[model samples]
Target: MISADTTPPLTAVDKGRVTLLYHFVRLQMPAVKVSEPTFLTHLDRTFRIFIPKAPGPVSWAAYLEGLYAVDWLVCVGCLTGQNGAWEVLFNARTGRSDCLLVDALRARAVRLYPRDEERQDTAVTEFWGNLIAPDSAGTLPVLARYDGQRPLAPWLIRVFQNWHLSKLRQSGGTTALPDDEIALPMDTPRADGADRWHETFIAAAREWLGSLTDDERLLLGLRWRYRLSQREAAKLFDLNEGTLTRRTDKLRDRALEHIGGKLVAEGWAGDDLEGFVLTELGSLLTDDPRLSADHLGRLLAARGKSLPAG
Candidate 1:
């Protein structure tokens, strides 16, 4: 449900944050850098994640592949290193107080104060005491707020960045994330990159899937809705495993082509559309309720199996 509202356009503060993040990552390595215009384009996609219906609680998607559509991937990577931080954030067997995510964030804090050991230690101390501390009810509010609608690693990275951003600002510092030589850039973001595009990605998905044939729809339903394996699904349709594989692959491509074309008609350019399909398309289709997988069971009465409860 990609709901719409009269929510005002991106504010100066939003642009400022994006500009800062864009410069933050580009300053690192060239190989990991995304162009400023491309970053701004994806920024719009990121803001849509928070469907802020006025005064109502923001409805967000489950966090299977959040970073899939997000910009500032390299910057995010810089904050959360590849240490299976995703698992540590919500692993049933792991503890939250001193997890891999915390360590990665601690490393980010270290980057903020590379030459100053005392400040680094103090920053890490404050982070643990404030964010990781359990409340009187014996629950960590920061970790508890995670609803699995977005990746915990990036969510925690934003939380960590905001913490430091506020701290530095409150301490009378002018920089967003202060370093000995680096600071977040201050510049306006270009909001017109994707002309006339107003988050119809989900709507397009619903229409595309709705147009599929019964058999075609059920093929997707078996995998996404019923959570059936390829062998099981193939057996259901009485097709060989190899033939089932090719058909599913074609369906995946067709979805991309259809969605990509819709966006292009809405003023998305070649590279911009490609950027989304390659990087962010996974987020929407991964666990979407309307478009891809969530409710297909209700539509599959022909299967004769008891439909799953809502």
Candidate 2:
């Protein structure tokens, strides 16, 4: 129904499906009195924003799953992350997901008062407030620009750093460099390098996984480790496939960036980090004892949650 070739808004089948879904959603959310036409208009805008241009969905139900997730968020008024979507989706064990991003960027505030704990705390608070504060146009600030294309964490890292850098320059502080300034370091070869690299990557991966909420952890395990398709993931989460695609795109991207960034910080060459993630991450997700589907299944079963029936 959303293909490039088809110019009519939605096919008759999609329109009918949307009407039925709207009624189903409204039954639970009686307070929202959005008219059908208005709802269709909103869904059109949603498709344009999130779906962009994928070959139309293979199934109607699959495509609509994302819409349901997004709409439910809209109705409940929690769709936006005070830090944005990150707050809702990621449970970074270090703290809340939004706080995690702000803390990471707080270091880049360019004006650091290192010794005084009170000052440091205030600076962190200020940086966070500014990161998500609305602009003069009333649009959300920095974090709202995420488009789900790049690896989430790294993209965030670059975006936050660049923004901080820009803010610093405007304030007449130090000259902040852009992303190229954080150049990828070169790799050095060694016989035991692969083994050591795998060990380090796995350690970081497990720590990162432990930081997530159980649901987020399982979602990743299902998508990456178990190789669930977007449709299957939608069923498991009770979301639309289009919506899962958007969320999982960010989820997977953010996770890999964390894993890769740890390796790079430990002195693996930029090339090695990219190479290992591209070539080896799948195996690690699928075969590692920690991330294996069977292990996660047992964990879920222990929690009394069952996978959706096929």
Candidate 3:
């Protein structure tokens, strides 16, 4: 029997079993969630973001498990540190091993928690080395033990930095919508206010197009006329993506507001813009691919010309 003062020595077979469990646990860690307020509060403070913000109450048990995985990743990183001094152990049957879930935990940590450059470089170097090592057994056990001891500061920082970088690339240093090709929900019911807004949008588009100079016309054509995504349009016009996005949003908002006012001018007195007729206008804007100010002008002119005189 092992003495009370002495730690039990793990045999070679026991070590091998533990190593296998370590990998298994790392693989499974991502699925865990932490819902307890205390744990979540701690995670929020560490990561600087509220996680898994569900529309309603979340499954707390699952959330707690996720937090546990975070704790485990820190330990694993320490085990695999440059001066690792312990063999990571695992018991598959008992479910105590956490290394299997490291991937997802690492991913989340990097995404939610931005870290300093120096620490990130070191952790990344260690992670890659362990991943490609000739014999994983030696490294995996050591990594598992390290992560079990430390708080996952490096991993969280790396995750946040990567997420920020990705957003920058996707937006192309501009605040414009990522893509011009939007897929809106089809189920949204038309309201009177929406209808009025639509009609105003069409009328305003016509009027605005008439006011544009030749250069402005060409730029507008390159964007809305050619149906280019923001990035594509930005490249054509030599404009920044974020700037273009902001410009478009501002333009759209102003146009909508103007349209709402136009309804009042037309003696539509419901006070709400929703009751106005706008279905045709919205359809004209969204469904037709060959939208041009010239084409729209011609269409509206034809409609006005066909109307009967009172």
- The best candidate by TM-score is 1
Which regions of candidate 2 are displaced past 4 Å? 1-8, 16-39, 51-162, 165-310
Global CA lDDT computed for model 3: 0.40
Candidate 1 collision pairs: 61-149, 62-149, 63-148, 63-149, 63-150
lDDT of 3 by residue, 1-310 (tens): 3222222344576555444434544465533332244332333232222122322332222222223343454343333342221122111111112222233333333332345455445444454444324234444332322211112332333333343446546767322222111122112345757666555567765565455454344444445534557896565446799977776676555545566566667666664454333333443443232243333333434434211121
lDDT of 2 by residue, 59-176 (tens): 3443453233323323222223323333432432221232444445444343333345675566556544554565457675544443222223434445554554466567885543
Model 1 residue runs over 4 Å out of place are 1-99, 110-120, 132-144, 148-154, 165-241, 283-310
The C-alpha stretches of model 3 lying farther than 4 A from their native spots are 1-204, 213-225, 269-310
Indicate the residue-level lDDT of 17 in model 3: 45
- Number of the predicted model whose lDDT against the real structure is largest: 2
Worst-scoring 10-residue span by lDDT in model 1:
180-189
Q: Give the TM-score of candidate 2.
A: 0.35
Q: lDDT (CA) for every model shown? A: 0.52, 0.53, 0.40
Question: What lDDT tens digits, residue by residue, belong to model 1 across residues 1-310?
Answer: 3354322354576556556656654654344445577665544444443444223433222222222222234323223332333233333121123345555565567665667788877876775555435535765445433333344454565566666766766888543333322121122232774324435666677667667886787787677645678898887777899999999998888887998888877766556565566444444444443433323443554665434343
- Scored by lDDT, model 1 comes in at 0.52
